[model samples]
Target: MISCACPEFALDNNPDTRAAMERITAAEADLLAARAAFYPQLGVTVEYNRTNNPMYSFGNILNQGLFTNTIDFNDPGTTDAIQAKGVLQYRIYNGGRDAAAMDAAINREQASVFDNETVRLQLQANIVRAFCSIVQAEEVVTARQSALEAISASLAVAQARFEEGSLLKEEVLNLEVQQARAEERLIHARHCLSLAQRGFLRLLGLQGAAVQLDAQGSPAQEIPANPDINRRPELQAMAAQIRMLEAMVRQAEGGHAPTADLFGSYQVDRGAEFGDGSGNSWTTGIRLNYALFNGGRTGAEVERAKALLREAREKRQHLELACTLEMEQAVLALHQEEERLKVTAKMVTSARESARLSRLRFKEGLLLSSELIDTENRLTDAQLSHSLATASRTIAIADLRRAVGLPQFNHGK
Candidate 1:
């Protein structure tokens, strides 16, 4: 029965994952602001002023209906006036600038969503690679332990033969030396496993979490025959960028056109001397504004925006070619690792048989101690090679999946 358990991908506690999610939220906020810009604004204003000017002194008195009490208007004294107002303003037209800006913001937000997915997939791939490393290292440690045990048995046999005068002291010493070397290798292998575990834990944001990894190697699978770059997040992001640049071009050209807004306000005026005779007024109108010229600034902005659009298109083209090359390379690597794994599997089987035969021959006086040690070393190396080949194949598969923008792995915890 399989005793290993696969990790589940947990993005909740990861710092980089949280950061990517936050970026998407920020982009959403920008999109909302862009949409809100299309609506009208309402505001209230209140003011109190004391004016001593000749024109305002008389005007305030008339406005407040206090002229009857101020019969000596020739002595136009200071006037204290209080005003409260409510204002409404709305942009009726702006040459499609708001539309372009909103479109650009929408594209940016979509791109951010794609970027977040890309980060997630990339992190999952990393986790897969790290876990595979730990699995490979653990296998190596197991292989080394097995080798140590076999060598210790051989050393005991040699010691017994030496005591019975059937083996030389030098042969026994040679077996002891091999035993020591095997033990040394086992120690190194265990250390490698420790390091791999540490790295795996750190990647999961669990610095000291006790865990058992179950990175089972999957059966050999066929590489993707035709991978499409369009589905890739990077390409989608580029496409969004192109759209945003096009929107920017529209926004820049909009500057050459006039803008119109509807504005209205209602006000109440009261004077200190004529508080009971307050007056109210209302005003409303549509305002038109045009930027006649700005020293070629508008023209320059339009040109710049067009240039940026072209640049984005060119970059997308370049990236498409690069992705194609990367996918091809990943596929080729997968095939190579698959072949290497097959060859190493055969080697491991043959080496194990040879080691088993050599142990028997050494015990029956048909093989020298040195010969047995050589066979044992070859078996250990074969096991290690097979382990590495298995890991390489697994990693290659993960890379190919990532190259084709496939989010298939479960990782974490």
Candidate 2:
């Protein structure tokens, strides 16, 4: 995990990150619902009826214990009845489908957690890239400003020589043109810096907020020699998926087995009055259900589940290989950038010394104006290249960290 204490670490504030978190919460709710399926269900029912049927009315009066000797047996009966009932049902067994479904739900929730972690890591990688861009832009602007100052000083020297009649007017004009070009480069660099800052803010989902980038250059940290790709969030998610598929296969196979349930109910019946004298009755029983035949539907479902399990295994194998390849490629790229940074650093030192000597020689009339201009241009190019190399190295390290599942930059260093 990245322990960076900078404002860039406000990753939870990002909408994508929050959305991923919500997915995990939803998966947890689904898991709870699945587990709840194992418990017994209880329900209540209330009913009222007014009837004038000879048989039904007589039966209702008997049930309520309200039958009287004065009632004529041959006459059609009338009944005003109210009943309240409570029922309890429990699944004794269901071909093991309930257990398998619960397992699948657990695995699904675990997979969602890994997926959420993957999203967080990806967001961290993006933030690192954006932060490095701002740093690169700043360096470029500083290099361009330095180059402009050098050219301006050269122009002043050329004008002074021209007035002393020691240098041609055309040479002074050439220096003036170089100064104009250098100024244009400085302006372009500043514009690029502004654009990069805007993009960084946008990535953080704080587009209108004023933010300052504090990174000066490449961050120093220990690079791991051997990283385990098995720890990657993507691989963890795939593993969870495989478990879920296996559980689903078990659930489908359970469809071929028999199911048993226990059920019980109690009722109170009142005649002619809502809450007056009443009679009560209760009953309990065990029921068994077996799917003797359903046109091979259960068989087809089992086959489909097995096929999905096979596909999930194959996909996991492919991703394992891909993860290995990605790790190797990222390591190679990081090494290349590290070497490039060193080469650019040396180039900047050599170019600066060469430019300094060229300027001294020009003042002593030992170097031509064109030679001096070439040295200055080489110095500017070297500075710019150094800046780019620094930024590239920083980004490469961030990429390597992500490939190894170390998503956040270590702010401790």
Candidate 3:
């Protein structure tokens, strides 16, 4: 495997991160729409009509400034009229419904931001876990390879002694059997390493790309003395959701009040064709709307909103508890991995010394072949254990940082 720097999330193009970013963009669009509702609306419309109806013909003729005593009131003839009107409308009051909508949008946008952050942090942890797994698997392969080599060397010596009639045939056969087992172990370790590498590539969104690792020794950071999940993005996101739900409740309540709006319009009317007649008019007024006969819809909306707010509040409590538990579990895992690493390191040292001494004794015909084989196997196991412990500790560090809403490897960045 080629050695390379750790994968960058921004470069990896993780689908989850991309999806989260899109959600944030959507939330921002909603916020913009909410803010736009606060401003006055201006629009233009054109209306054209041709009619012979007595009432409409008289009105159209009057608007066209062609009304006269000569006009027949009972059976006015056909008339054509076109009006180009420009209208402006502004909401003067809506019982704070618009304000509540704005607030809700603002909170939703905030929640989206925090949700994205939470997704990024969790993905980072997963990448670290995958990366660590590959490193540990590779180390195990190395340990297995070393074990196989040691067994081969011991078997060669046993065969040589048996050829000279100085060692029992059973002893040489034992060495041969152990050598085959060692080869099997090595093959299995390599298989596992390959699987781990492929998994890492998939996690990086680089399915067919080469596998590599920065192989920077485990993070040097220790268990945090003050484990705090207050800054965890998941919890913050939930808090924002709760606030958004509260605003929705307020918006539903505002539906009970009447709405007032200020409106103004200017119109230019072209009268009967080929008559060189026209009329211009301007009007300004206020409009009020009261939903006096809705069948309990407003009340139902209010109740539904209140129910959602209560659910959000409960979810917030549950989210906080879940985050706290995660933080505690991460801390304890870090401590446990730390102890395991230390223990494995000691075991490797002792086993290495024992294997070295056993090899010397076996060479001098003072140690049994079985004893020498056991020592070599212990050394290999100890090495593999140490490697796993190291990787686990590194992963634990990343997990703890994720729980605290910190960066994966580097502390601040």
Rank ordering of all candidates by TM-score, starting from the highest: 3, 1, 2
TM-score of each: 0.91, 0.90, 0.93
Candidate whose lDDT is highest: 3
TM-score of 1: 0.91
lDDT of 3 by residue, 161-242 (tens): 8888878998888888999999999899899988998887676666677776767643455555687998898888888888
User: lDDT (0-100) at residue 277 of candidate 2?
Assistant: 44
Best of the two (1, 3) by TM-score: 3
Superior candidate under lDDT, 2 versus 3:
3
Query: For residues 129-238, what per-residue lDDT tens digits would candidate 2 score against the true structure?
Result: 78778778888888889888987887788778888888988878878888888889889998988888777776676656655765533356447568768678888998
Clashing pairs in 2: none
lDDT of 1: 0.83
